[model samples]
Target: MKKALTTIFCCILLISMLSIVEASSHRRDIYDYKGSSTGFAREKVNYSLFNAENFTGTRMDLTGNSSADSFIGKFFGTFFNWIIGSTSQSYLSFNGTDLDFNETFLNGTIDTRAIAVNATMKLYVDAQDIVFNDSLKSYTDAQDIVFNNSLKSYLDAQDITFNDSLKAYSDITFVNITGDTMTGDLIVPNLTATNNITITNNLDIGGNMTLGEKITFAFGEVIDNIVNGVIQITGDLLVTGNVNATKFFGTYNWTEDSPLLSFDDTTLSFDYAGLNSSYDSRYLNLTGTNANQNLNVSPFNITANEFFGDINATFVKIALGSGSPTIDQMQEYLDNTGSSGFFTGGIISDGGSGTIDITAGQGFIRTTADDNAPLLSFNWSAQTGVAVTDNTTQYVFVDDTGTISLNSNEFLEAQDNIILGLATDEDGTIESVFNLGVRLEESIGQAGRFIRRIHSVSRDVRRGGLVFGETGTRNITLTAGHLWWGRTEY
Candidate 1:
């Protein structure tokens, strides 16, 4: 009985396993093989039908030489090699920083419509012409486009303006220059003669220009100009302003009015012919050697050490020789000397044969003070040509005042009348004085007798009596004569 049961269980389990395998096989066969052998063939592939022309999908026709296939195979081979981390190159190679072309050149023109380069780009080509239709801005390290080892010229259509300053390294010459207006200052630091610059038309400098070297005007004349330094010209100079020079040599002929001073040859004449008056108010000064200089006209005030011509003046005053005399001293000297007229100062001494004759007026000689004695002593002989007299002859010494005594060797002799007490008052009136004379008159009836004139009459007479007395003690002494009081007694 246990064998029968074991055989039955085995049969059931096999049936169920077979069922699961059959279902799985059917689903796979329907989905994978389209459920039949007639829907799918199991033969070998036809290689001739698998060509690029026969296929309607995106395809590439390989050349007769199979270049496309060779290129694709080579590209895949290089890609696989690069995926394996290899640096081996077939055409292009990149060694981390540089892409090398491996000395191969591109033959065709590459039209890159727009390109941007973050780093510096360099083209190592010869004879390349690059043109730009739009603007070209260079933002290099120096902010400049430098054409190395070449000369370049620029032709600007509009205004080529510099926002800051514009500098030129070499000389620039304008060949076909038109109207160029520079609104700013053009600075040239070192301009040599080899560096030449040419410009046409008018050059108007609005600012101050300093010239370090000498400037020469070869042909044209300079008008409305001033030269600060000394100017020497070969031509004539006509100055409209005043010329102040230290020394000037020229000849001038003036034809104006009022010619006060004139120079002719070696003579400087001050002609007052054009003046309104005899004296001119202008001053004439002469300097230098006075010996050779001559003044043709006389000036009002002249200062000189010596005068050559005659001087006529109403009064002549001479300075004193000695001492610095004041006005008071001069007045005292004039007053004491009693010389109040002209020729006030001088000493006139006649050492030669000269005489001071006073024929017209009365001559008076008196001492200034009373301490000086007045004496009139004469020692003149009747001899001619006697400069001095000898003291042997008697001279009458008369004392006009005080007591008079006669010398034993001298005698008084009167030529005319010897009148005593003859005086003149302030009114110039002559007064009566004691007159002792021998007057033989017909009215007096006296002859050869001494008479006294009193009121034009003879009153008291004492013959043979001598009057001897002083000023207040007069006494009469009679030897043998009678004295009458009111008449003459003989």
Candidate 2:
């Protein structure tokens, strides 16, 4: 009997242990396992075990809405809640502690209140609350916060801190700041750095500007009233304005050796009324005043209209006006460059019925040569006039109106033939008249020697020698070797 009782006690203990295992197994199934509701009767299963009130440990379900709630809502919520909640309640606690559900951690709707985090501060949100504190001096340990739309009021209130490696504020505006140095590209919708802004170093602007009428820089101020004004200069102050003034003047040194000023017009004018001027040996100066106005240069008390010079002390002065051109002075103007000199002096004319008077130097004539020596020299200083009128076929009227005179030392030489006519009784007939004054010479030695003399006149009718008949007779003396012949009718 004693052995049976002991065995009976052991069996009862085993059965109790088996019951506990079965209850724990069922609890594990409710907490860690998930299946189709169709597998078990809904009325027979316990549903309260999956609720937040009864679920005590980490639970993972693989099916149903409960599975989604567990993985997305519960798992991430619990994790972040614990982390943030442990600090204080200064931040909102998740579910009841100091944490909250961040929708970024999951892809579905979640009951953030159901998730809990340990925190110290109470989480409160006011619509009209000041988002930024201007008086907050230190940003060394500040936390980050994000806002929806613009932070205009925040930036206007206080200076913000950027602690990350990269930070960006797109489409932002800030107004009214008092700071000495700013490092970065400053983009403003319309900015005016006005009045007494001094920059010691380089200021690089990377854009263009459009101006209205004019821009002025004065009183040690550099003002850019246009948009995106950029002035890039390598050395000194570069100004883009209609009027620019330099206060403390200094000598400007240029790196480029050749400097040029170009104008895109056909004419340029300059008025140098009050400016002092000097010219260098290496520079050429050209000045023009008006459209048709001539340039006059007065140097060394010698006034001139135009002066052209070279490097070798050769100079030429030209007098330009409406009348004739005059050469005032020339230094080394013409040299021995295989050139020739020409001098013309004479007069000539064709004498006919009209009275033509050719003076000493007034005529249409020219003188030229091949070897730079005068070939033909003509001087029509004296006038010779001869007049002859045709009266008949064989007779002409000669009128010696002017005094026929010739130079004593200059003798006239006739190489061609000469003809003379006399009056006749027939209407168109001519006869030669002989006089005692007519004479001829045979040689140069007999220039004044008379070779022939007329004595008498006769006619012959039978031989037709005197067919017209001769009526005039004259006597003349003859030389010894000459013979006198006469004719008579048969």
Candidate 3:
């Protein structure tokens, strides 16, 4: 009982000392890593005495203060280390004097990247994935636009909206279609709507669209060389640039560069044989500028009175005042269309050449049947002015460097003559072409139409044979998983 009371008194004294230590703040030796240019930096160093430039054979503690070989009962005039105890460990710190940190501070390098903001944070770029751009694109791939052949007659190509506030092209969408047939009126009043259209390949349109008004094209939008159209304008027409039309029905002024239709002062001309360099302009002009008009066809080489593209079309019309005329008046109109009747460019010209040789006079038209009605007449006109050569039989030669390996089960059918050859040692020379080939021609008699002509490239194989019949299909059989050739014996 006496020993228990003695332990209680010592416990109370220990509790009082612990309370003082809990209330005080210590300078914690924080590992402030300021530079880790690479990675982790933790180097070990030894501790030593200051006076002697030699280590005490002891290492510094983690706090870089306490040493393993610290001196006991050592005091440098009121400067004492920590009290030597056996229970809890405490670091010894000396004040009023500078510490010799010559080689004792370990892990002196700080990890600069550990506290860097860039290394620890991430940047976002997509919205749906919880990321975003600066202004945040609000696009959704819900397929709101549709494309199909049903849109042909609908003219849905002009699917543009006008924003009155902005006054510019906004909400632009690009649509593409394949094998699409567009038929309806695509009226684009403001031509700027064409900016957002792309056609990668053949864009076949089967209808017409009125560009109406206030629409113009950039340089490549319409090709000047291949622009084919028939222009029919009734009112006053004004064209700032050149016009390329197959036929024009309006009274207009044309320059020398205007094709098909041009005006040489008073003469209105149309270009015949536009696809050739040797072309002519057949025109008709009035004799005087005043009211007493005398029409003349002073320009002749003018073969026909009809236009090419017009099929059975009455070019001009005349009103008869709803009154009938006599045979004499009808005959006069049929001869000249003089005042009463409009001109019907007779029956189609059968390419006959008959010259009247009446210079600078009114033209005449005579209509008649060919070969007196029932006939099988031959007509020929040799191409003049151009040099001619000994005409040879035409054959198509297809050259291929590598082997054209075909499936043994599939049939290689040809319409006319199919010549399979090596295309010669000289790549595309025609004389060297027919050296190696198998050709098939149609026979005159009905027993067989296809005639096979084969030439041999190998002496060991059966090279030539004939196939008599209509154009039929034959497969190159596979005898042993390889294509077999030379089917016929001879």
Candidate 4:
């Protein structure tokens, strides 16, 4: 019994020694401790035997070369169940060179040849991916594409190529293409119809191009020149430039159309070579010399210094010089009613010493003919300073019926002395006896002097008679002389 107890005791001591060895083999370092809990502490002590360096260097390297039988026999023991078709371990092989993954990661540089999807493919490049392909022809899987590049030459002919099956949509906005010339014809397919088409360069519209609407050239905008077929406008045309048209026509078709011409507060100058018109009339025609002529329409309120014209109207008002215009028989035929008249403000004439034969109906005022033809005839030579005073308080009979009565209070005064006579008939015979009177007042050496005289003459069926009488007082001391008088009558 003592021997049996000694054997059991020895077995118990061996089991304790194995437990100590197991514990020592799994003893963890400070860095290997994941946690301090009971379960985690046990795992940490077990896993401490396989450190990163030892597992990678010694354990995995040895296991990678060992056969399955020897590997299991050495490490896992005889009771270890085999995992079928599995190697003891596997390792990555590197021969002191860069390890190229032949298979690209999602963040690695892509081989364009490897970009193949059955349908439309969209490959998005990340920031870490740097493409190295000089020519982009290797990417053939996408239906639509968008690329962002900093270099402009990347889209040049050498860098990019197109597939005939693919449709390209390129947009390079905010890119300026200045100072570049294009040679071929450019065709834009989907532009709508408009009134104006603007191009930066000169455009040549080929063939007989037809426009659907009217073309308007705005004011202050210039068109260099136009070579056209025909421009037809369905409305009014306003032209400010020199027009070279085959024909021009205008008509008053609207009810609100004004006259063809209108004048502002300005002058209209007709400098044409000649003017012609039909069925024209005017209210006033003030014509003058052609060189410096002015056809003034309204001269009523004009303040100019001089005016010249042959003013023919209902009444002419002359503001400056004047003369008596004769209306001869021919002029009378031309103007039957004498409506064409000249009424001047003032008139002065110097018709020498001969008698001025002022015909009937001719005077400053409007006149008409009658039986007593009171024609004015002035003989300046025989009428020098003639003083004729009709101061009698009696009525003078000019003809058998016509009589002129003088004012009793007023007398006609003349500066000089002259004989009085009447207008003669066709036989140069005096036609009537006109009553007359004479008075003289003078100053001799500054003293007042008065002289009065009276005369009476009558022509009748018998021989006419003449009587003379005088009575007055003079301030000067004078002696009287014999006075003689003569009278003649028919």
Best by TM-score: 1
Tens digits of per-residue lDDT for model 3 on 1-490?
9999899989988898787565333222223333676955545344223333233322224434544355533334223444434432222233435333323222222345544544455322232344443224333223224333445434455433212212232213223221242222343434445445643345445566455333224432332222244333333456789978665453555566656667855578666544233342233332343324433323323244543342211223334554563322333333343111111111111111210110111111122222122111111122211111122222222112111221112123131112222211222222222222322122123212222223234333423343334344664432222222434342
Pairs in clash, predicted candidate 3: 33-110, 33-111, 34-110, 35-110, 126-131, 152-183
The lDDT of each candidate is 0.35, 0.34, 0.32, 0.33
How much is 164 displaced in model 3, in angstroms? Answer: 29
Best by lDDT: 1
TM-score head-to-head 1 vs 4, winner: 1
Residue-pair clashes per prediction, in order, are: 0, 21, 6, 0
Taking all chains together, each candidate's TM-score versus the true structure is: 0.21, 0.19, 0.16, 0.18
RMSD of each: 31.6, 25.9, 35.0, 27.3
Poorest stretch of ten by lDDT in candidate 3: 354-363
Clashing pairs in 1: none
Give the per-residue Cα lDDT of candidate 1 at 353: 29
Evaluate model 4: give its TM-score: 0.18
- If ranked by lDDT, best first, what sequence of candidates would result? 1, 2, 4, 3
Please state the error at residue 354 of candidate 1 in Å: 60
Put down candidate 4 lDDT per residue, 1-490, tens digits, no spaces. 9999999999999999999887677654433325655633333322234222232222221212333322322343222333423231232222333223333343333444345541224343432235524224455323124443323345454333432111132223322332233333445444566445655565555545554554545443333333465444545556669879686444423332224333332432332222223212232233443435554534233334664565443334433335764443332332343221112111111122321121111111112332222222112211221112332222211111121222223322121211122222222222323323221112232222111122223223223233344457643343333332222223
